[model samples]
Target chain A: MKGFLLTIISALLVILVLNVGYYKEWFQAKPLQYWTDFLKEKDDTLSIEGVMASRYGVAYTMSMRIKQVLEQKHVTNPVILFEPNSYLRDSLHLYPKIRVPEPAVFYYYTGLEGVWINSPDTGKASFLVRISSKGVGLDVIKTPEQRHQLLAFYKKYPPIL
Target chain B: MPFLLFIFLFICYLVAGYGLLTIFKMQLKTAYMITLSLLLGIAVASFVPFLLQLFYIDLNPASIFGSLVLVALVLNIPTWRRIIKEGFPAVRRSFALKPFRILSYEVPYLLIFGFFTFVSIWRCYYLPPTSRDALSGPEAIAEFAVREHTMINSFFNIDLWTTNNQFKSPYLISLQMICKIAGFPFGQVWLSVVFVSFTVFLYHALKERLHPIIAGLLLLLFLMTPEMYAYTFMILYDYSNMIFFFLSLYFLFGYFKSGIRSHFYFAGLLMGIATYIRSETLALAVLFLPAILLSQRRNKDSLAKIVKANAFFFLPSFLGYYLTAQLWIKYYLPIHYDIGGLVNGHLSDWQPLFQRYSDIVTHLMASEFGIHLWGYILYFTAFLFVAEGIFVRRYSRDARNWLYAIFVLYLGVGALGFLLPMMNLNETTKRALFKLLPLAVLYLANNELLIRLSQRISRWEGTPSYLFAREPRPAPTPIAPTPAPAKGKTAPTVAKAAPASASRPSPKKRKK
Candidate 1:
């Protein structure tokens, strides 16, 4: 019986030690941000966003809508991308519009794009989006006809799923 | 949960198998006990490291796996079976049923086999594949082989290449083939299979020659040591080379004992194969040739007879490597260009040979004796045993020869390491040397001390002499009784005299 107890204790201790070591990043690779940034600089126009939504189409639509809102607010950026909801909320302070209730109407700041806004009932923000300068609305339609035509075209094609 | 279940089932299988051996009369109780002890010892050792890892104490996988294999090999089992056949007449005459009964004269081996299997699997799962050497050397070779569909001559402009260069050992190629057949990524399982198989083979081979208890203990020592297990699972050339080297020795010894020349041929073939794995193993081949020649000379064999006997063993062995090397040289240089430069540069390094030797000695002593403190306890114990054997000359000639060979080989390898100026004589090499060193010491020690002690005690007191002298015996009756003159008259004096006279021999008879 004593032997059995000792075995169990030893096994548990091993499990605990392994769990701690894994969390402590003992096996983690060294920092590679510099390499990542160098690679990203090669393709200035392209922006990559990692998302974990259940539906790809929904996530795509949400990203496009956010991009459109930012453009309307005269936020010209090279790239505008939506992060996953879980990760976005985790870093809520880094993004503008604390509580975004609906997918279509995303509450964003006109002035400093990433300013926090609090909703009393709903609590903190739902998502955070990043916008680069290249993606801003530098080119504008002079007349209403151009804008209508652009919206019509977007409605027909829609964003990819 | 699945892993735990696996462990439990494995343990159960081992216990059951050992129990079955007992039921079948195939092994004695001592074998079971020794195997159990080995299993427990390994379990504890493995668990301790694992626990340390959990507490964020990271360790190199090579050290762990190497230690595990060493431990398993050290715990030896000594048991042989005698087969007895029994014919049952109750069955139909036409059937002629004969049941073979196995009478175990020593310890059980099946339990040991089960333990080996479990630990091998455990080591495979926990240890990562060789990421260091494999990522750099073998991977490049493998990729080139896959692209060309044939062996290449040079790697990175260095000649001395072969298509088989991608594989550290032919056994690794076989492992890859198995993974391929299973429709799995060959790289994923290749190293694990090679590592596990090498350890298993070593354990079985060593067990065949040594007593089970000693073998088990020695195996444990080797496995638990930091180097063997660590490298065993790594996709490096060294571990595989060591395996093949030991395997060659194993077959060589078998050939010597049985006079089966074929075993020698296989041993030579393995030695040849080992050269491709690590160029260093070539030294072993060189050493073995002279040893064989010396043995032949010692036996006083004729020159022609010796040549003929050795030819059978050397021909295929030489041809295998020669052909392979020739094919490689056709496309590339005979020697690897970088290797010469590396060797020379290392030779000119700053470290002194004596300093390196002392470092190696220190590490070896610590690993064996100290447990964790001094570590030299193991080395000291082994040294004591070998010394005792040398002095007493009590063990069998074969054991003495094996011990001497081990000592010579250990020193020879150490000398090679020392000669290489840049070679870091660190804890790792010391640990690797410990695998064979401690076992050799134990073998000599156990035979001289344990066996001799038993023999001495047996000799001091003769059997059956003391028991008979201490016990009382009945007196013998008289040979002749004087006739009673009067039947009623006191016949007591005559009867007593007759009995006394009958009991004692006459003086004339006694003198004669």
Candidate 2:
């Protein structure tokens, strides 16, 4: 009876280990599309920007979020490719700059023109963003007209997104 | 390369600590050695670099390596030879079948600990520093050190040193330098190894006093604690403090049993390291001194002898607190506030102070989330200690009873000292209670009522030997009866020494 109990426990342990593996994403080799779709479908519109990904997929969703946000703002003329977003990487690496809400990404959104957006603040709010396009403070988005000019400037960039 | 260096430094620390214990004439228990060595290694890493950095040397891999080499040459190498020649065989023998022959059942508790430990290690790799303190405190301190490649902090741009003076201690910064030297991003794997080793040590400590099964069960209970398991992967120094504080108590208990001066020194040194790990552990020095002195039971000793022993115990602890405060005072910003300020702040405003005290005490009793099961254990243990009084001799000797009493007193008093000054007592209570949790576990595991309850359970479960079971062989010589202290002339009976003072001297003078 004890041996039988031992076998049952061993089986249960194996099952539990496999379940842990599945939840931890250790087993399957899922694509970025799977995650992007999962995030996009998890919530409509703003959820793309809102959803926090696992630490491994932080860069992927970050670049994807920027792509989705630009698509929403009608800045479609430029090709947007985020190359590991050094500004955000460096910001996250910087101890004081990193806060409770996980800093998402600081991307050089290269389109018709390349822009460096330093989004140190990651929260429910979308208004507080630090973006620099063309030159220092050239199309800095402090107000609506500046936001439009920034988008218009990006609208001239080649479509690669 | 960085991973290899971390492993290398870790092994060097283990060897160093093991050798030191052997030199101190400790029994050389592997679990105890592993845990003690890891903590001592961290303290050494922190202190060595700190002294180097004082001379305008940059705190980097080269300096850290140089410090390790100096330590190895000075103390570790000679001690290592003695440890291998004399201690290795004894340690190996402990793992032989002789110890396990008496025990019948190996419960599933170990399996549970293994699962959680595996999960914690996995999470360390998978997760980033997400906890609030981790983001801005020790992890941040390490990042700053690595980025600058120096221990000197030029900018006080962040409020990192207000309540966060604990970070100014070079332990985390030294560790961070090691990690940077190794090439791994700052993760909890190193901390996880330390945490897991601590649990192993806790198990051994308990096993010495209680049934192996009970020890295993209690250890499992401790590991399964929600906050403790989470903090194992979280970059916080509090858990390490918890382990060191518990080890100090373990050594204190060993001293009480054998009356060995080295055991007392070990307790003192571990307490000091605990204080260095977290400033709050400074209270332990104040808490333990009375317990230790009272446990001595030696009234005939000269004043000089008493003072020397007291100095031996407290000097390390004072140094631990000093190492931490000195870093802030000399190099970085001065400590803005401490326990003294808290007392003065509360004293001036009695009404608010009373209100805060009432709220914190009430919350401690009712706290469900942070303190977890340990809170309930504390509540129950306090009740048992009060109700039991000094009427029963659950343990054989009065010194053992006094040691337990002092520890319980320390836990209760230490918990309040941590809570009284806090801005958010509710949020801080869990971590504050962690310092008390190990002591609470010891109390519960050894409580007369709990022992009885467990014996009943063990009988029903068909276990061979119950907790507190007498060995099959005859017991050792009972302590000799001696003159008791006058009533009201002595401190509380819980703080009194053994009945016989002469029995202690032989162990006191014996050299390794």
Candidate 3:
């Protein structure tokens, strides 16, 4: 009887191990998906960027793209005033349908500073992120007038989470 | 070469840990000694780099490695003296190797736990520190510390308005700095050491309470808890905080059962370590104080002796809190943070506290969505609790004690929300509750019904020696004949630690 009980438990534990992803979510992806994706990839291309790209697929790409634009444009200590998640996601229907990550996360990904409309220093932003019917693009505020005008318009939307 | 360096550093940790435990002289099985020493060793060595920074010493590899050896040597001074006095080989001979007698029932649990552990370690190794909490706080600080060779690196000059991670304890910072300097770029493999050691220690602890099969089953459930398991790899303070806090309570329970002073101090040291990891733990440490103060028998132990015992147990955490706050925040960081400003201002209002507790129960504990978050572990606990209430109608001493600790932990985290308004429900309260799971598992292990079933299973398997079956030895006259706790055979007393104070010296001085 003890053996029977042990066998039943052994089987149950194995089943749980295999199906861990059924309940466990790592981020946007299930844990099983992450495992499958991780195991399939070869380690021949090991780098910090590769690891970021692997864990965060599209969100990472967008951050790097913005970073590329900033570096090419020679914007130093780039402070980006971000459009709210409701506007960016619902209005623009952003690719991947994911809301914009808050400023700290953005800062973590790309060393450039990010600020939401509700940020205390939000109006002092050097660059304003604007969304058109086409897609998301970085809008450089050349003067205090443009920064103020943009902040006034952006404040109408819901605060980015 | 880096792998070799990792191994070398680990050996230093082992020696340091072994020495510390040797000084304490707590009687534990070889397995407990080894695993606990390794974990404690890692924790001890983590402080080295931080201490160097506290003294304005550079954090280069050469400085870190040299300081490690020096610290390890200093910690093991007594042990080395013992070895010299009693010949090294004879002292070594005393430590006879005890092979782990793994029964057939334990095989499945071990295999799966081993597999998951490998995955966790690999992920931790392969990935950089990308968690928002770490990157924003400790990891960012560590990266710059390595580059600049100081804890007060350039990471702090930037505006850190969105997160207050900069103010966290330097425990992770110190270890991450040491590991990064030692060549593990991610600087998180130390977590792997902690994880493996804790699992072994917890499993051994559970086995002593019930049959291996039942223990294994409960542990397997704990291992499979979805959200908690994610932390095994993820670099966070909560996991380590939970381990030390639980172990402290375990030893505290032991002291309660055995009437041993060493056990009392050992429990304090663990709580101190936990407090060092997360300073908020110092507040939670007070909840267990009532248990200690109340444990004194009426009129037998003097008020002075009782107060001294309570102070000794609470002192380590106070020291730990001091090291965390005064050294790290007040001195090390180049920023001004109002510690008092972080406290919730509306203390008179009970509404927020009630709201905080409601969210904890509705969203984190009993809600259907909670099953998705924490899986069935909470439900399993609730089920066992109901079963015990209906059928058994009796609780053992340990079970009763465990339930008290679990409630203390639960209400403690909820109270933290009231105390610190910044502590959110999903992240702070949710993760802090990870400490509660093991205590609940212990409660299950001590359940009368579960113990009874485990006994029946063991009897069927032809094992006579089990929990509650052993002959009661005569109460040997203890140093203090303070009343033997009315344990009611509930606590699977793992051999009452015989020598209370005569055996081990008081805190630091060699002999009493």
Best by TM-score: 3
Candidate 2 C-alpha error for residue B35, in Å: 3.7
Q: By summed lDDT, which 10 consecutive residues of candidate 3 chain B come out lowest? A: B470-479
TM-score for candidate 2, residues paired by index = 0.66
Q: Which digits, one per residue and each the tens of the lDDT, describe model 3 over residues B288-337? A: 87787666652246787778878988999998999987667987688888
DockQ score, prediction 3? 0.32
> Candidate 1 — which residues are off by over 4 angstroms?
A1-161, B1-116, B122-128, B143-182, B186-215, B311-336, B345-356, B364-387, B390-395, B418-423, B427-446, B450-512
Q: Which is the winner by DockQ between candidate 2 and candidate 3?
A: 3
RMSD of each: 24.3, 11.5, 6.2
> Number of the top candidate by lDDT?
3
Q: Determine the iRMS, in angstroms, of model 3.
A: 3.7
DockQ leader: 3
- On the 0 to 100 scale, the lDDT of residue B201 in model 3 is 82
For candidate 1, lDDT tens digit of each residue in B1-512?
A: 43443344234333333332222222112322333223223222323223233343333333333433443333212111211222332112212323733212112333333443444444343323333334333444333333333223133332112122332332333232222222333233434444444444444433333333334444444544434444544455555455555556655654443233444565665565556544445554666667677656644567987788677665544544443343333333333433233343455663555555565556545443334322223554566566665786455434554565565556656656766433445533543353354335334333444333333322333322211111001111112232232222222121121111132223332101
The global C-alpha lDDT for each of the candidates, from Candidate 1 onward, is 0.38, 0.51, 0.74
Lowest summed lDDT across 10 adjacent residues in model 1 chain B is found at B469-478
A3: Cα error in model 2, Å: 12
**Which TM-score value belongs to model 1?**
0.45
Q: What is the TM-score ranking, best to worst?
A: 3, 2, 1
